[model samples]
Each structure stands twice: as C-alpha cells, then as structure tokens.
Target: MMRGLPAFFAVLLAALLVSPTSARAEGPLVLAAASLQDVMVALADDWAARGCERPVLSFAGTQAIARQAAAGAPADIFISADRQWMDYLQKGDHLQADSRHILARNRLVIVAGEDGAWLGDPAAFLNAVEGRPLAVADTESVPAGRYAKAALTKMGVWNRVEGDLARTENVRAALALVERGAAPYGIVYQTDARASKAVRIAGRFAPRAHAPIVYPAALLKTASHEDAAPFLDFLTSPRAQAIFRRYGFAPAANDR
Candidate 1:
C-alpha cells in the first residue's frame, strides 16, 4: 500500500484544493514552473526551518501556471521559466508590478540516453539520430521547447528534425522521455539534466542560439497571504541564489 503521496503530487493536490473563498493555511501558495521542482522544494524547506510556514507549491508548464493566474487562481506567487509567461500575467494585471524581478537563469542542453559520441557535430548528430524521435516540450507554447526550436533552427537543423519530434507538455516531461529511453534524445534545461542520473548531457546550445533563459517571479495581484511578499523576497536572497547555483542554475542577470 502507498504510505504517503509523493512530494510533487502532494503539493499539487494542495494547490488544487485551494479556492478564493476557502480558508487558506498560513503559508503562501506558489505556482511555479515544472523545471523548478527540486530547487523550489529545498527553498521551501529552508524557509520552514526558519519558523515560517512552508509555501504550498504547484508545478506545471509556465503556460498552465500563467493561465491559472489569468483565471484568478488564489495562489499568492508565480514563478515562470521564461519571461514570456510572466509578461503574459503582468499584461493581464494578474501580478504586482513592483514585486516582479528576475529570479534565476539556466542553460539549454541536449540529453541522450544511449551511449555514444554522436553529438560532437550538429550535422553528424542529426544523421546519427536519423529516425529516432527527439523529445521536446511543446514548441508553440512551452518555453523549453521554444528555446530548443530556436537552437535547432539556428544550427540549421530544425527542418530536418521537425518530422522526428516527440513533444511533451513541459520541459520535465521531455527530460523524462529521454531518461526512460522512450525517446533516444531530448532537449531540456541544463538543470534538468543535472537532476537525473538516467540521462547524460550530450551537448549544450550556445546562449546566442536562443533568448536568454530567464526565470522571473512576482507576487500575484490577488495575493492575500501575509507570507507572500516575504517568500518572494526570500527567493531572490543570496542564500536562495546559492541554492539555485548548487542546482546548476545561474544567477539571474539584470535582464529587464
């Protein structure tokens, strides 16, 4: 029998149960990108250790979270993997403008499940990958997939691989496909590859290949929790940045 729910699912369930009129717990509710799973949990735990209520976290694609905010979800905070989604919420007046800021940054990498030196050259890698599916997030809506598409297009290989894609809902899902060998290869964040031992980083896309990977966060305009602003501040603290760096995320630049 299952003794307890997994951490991710438990938090997701908590988030789903929360509504505008419901009695909220003392902690802030955070809707963050799926790519932030491990780091966010660690940060929440660290906050709780400091005599604060742990933030309730919900992880999904940035698009999903942004949509939730647009629908006026009672969540207190939003952290997006890319600025586009954050901008989406801000445009809709869903977030507190002054509370918005860059959180952390990351790099894009190609990961592989099979053992081989097949990624040394993009052309050679494409040839080696011939018919196998290359997993990626949804290029039209998901940030990771959009970055991967830009990188591939810049390398002049997008057309060649377009027909062989295996798209998933989020970056983590793409990483999972590669980890499980359901797809021979995948394009995901460097932090994602670092989080798993099942897949190895085969190559990294140059920063110029796509827009900078920026994680922007803000307190929601609908925020009602007393801990919301404080928790948002905690995320940008040097202590939190250190944890992010430990997980392979780079310090956020003054990109705005």
Candidate 2:
C-alpha cells in the first residue's frame, strides 16, 4: 500500500504540471486613474467575455497610483490620467518603455446638479459661482485638480475662488460632493459627468484652458502575469477603442 501511494502522488503532480495554462493563470492587476472607472470596468468585462482572465482593476488618483508604482507595488499595469505621472514612472524605471502606449485623451468640464443654463464665458461662470464652495480634487497632487486649477487660472479666477474651494481626494469624490449638494458645483473630467445621472455638465473648459488631458497605459517592469502584455494590447484594440469612444474619450492619435 505504501509503495502504491508514492506512485499515485507522482501521477497527480504530473497531471497538475500539464494542466492548461489558463487554468493556472490569474488576471492581470491594473492600477488605473479614478476617472476611468466606467470604461475600464466595461472593458475588463469584455475581456473576460472573450475567455481571457478578467483583469483586476484598481482605481485611484494618478499621483496615488504613481506613488504605489514607485514603491514597487506588484501590479501588472498602470494607466495614468495624464502624461506627467506616466513620465514620472518611466523616469523612475518602473515601467516597460516599449510597452508604453497613449490610450486616449479627455476634456475638462465644470459640473453642477442644478438644471439652469448659464451661457457665459468661464470668467462669468466663476463669477456666478462665487461664494459657493466649488468641489474639486486636490489641485496640488491630483491630475484632475491640477487641470482644474490651470483652467481657472487661465480664466483669471483662481485667486478669487481659491478660498471657497472644496477639495476632495479624487475627481469622483468631488462629483459626489456636488451630487449630494455638499457643493453646488464641481470640476471633473467630461467622462465623469457623463457617467453620473446626478449631475450635468454646466460648462466645458476651452482646449487651451490647461495642458492636454492624456491617458497613457503601460506594463510595470515587475509585472509577471502571463496576461499582462495581452491585456495592455487589448486596451488599444478596435473593440476597446470603441468602448472608450462610447465613454467620451478621444483617440490617442488626437493628442499628437
């Protein structure tokens, strides 16, 4: 009986070793910017539907995720809300240079819960919004906030409204502040306002309001998942780009 037990264990080990790779592989872990919540989730589901391992999505502010990458966090992919953070990771040697791709571009907009229309320039909008706390992401560390600050500064209203700002950790949270009436207005990505039924885009910043809003995706240098490269490629595929377009993202080529 003891002799037979050894043979049986050996056969089981061999069977396990020869099993299909898909059975043994886990989904890639994707650390993406918060503004990508809707589209990324949809794409992950689509990827899984094609019999691939569903990617695990982690969303946060660009700075937050960039800091995690810098700390050597074990994620297969990193997608930033802007080029600055992507450049930060690339500069730190945390990203695979060849794997980097500009996924999409976006526009910034001011959102509000109210239904009234304001047909005025950005300066007039700021003047109308005076005294009320305007919700925005952390202007110093977050990409969305930084863009909002740049746009407001361009409109020459940053100094006037800086004192009445309601800052949140991320753009989604800022949106929530407006939704719940914590603030009458919030500044967020165009995609964000589109995703939420609670708010409507009150105004859109001019293209030159701030630096271009670009989303760049890349595999991490420490990525070991078998599906990492494929998933990253899938992000730019026709199907994926279609999904992005449906969610208000511009093509990567538009950035250049």
Least lDDT summed over 10 consecutive residues: which range in candidate 2? 11-20
Model 1: pairs clashing at backbone N, Cα or C within 3 Å: none
Best by TM-score, which number?
A: 1
Error of 2 at 218 (Å): 0.7
Give each model's whole-structure lDDT.
0.87, 0.85
- Steric overlap count per candidate: 0, 0
The regions of model 1 sitting more than 4 angstroms off are 1-14, 17-25
| TM-score on alpha carbons, each prediction | 0.90, 0.87
Tell me the tens digit of each residue's lDDT in model 1 across 1-256: 2543364455455576644422444588899999999999899889989999878778889998887777667789999999898888888888887888898999998899758444867887787666889999999999999999999999989988899999999999999998888898889999999999998988889999999999999999989999999999899999999999999999977655
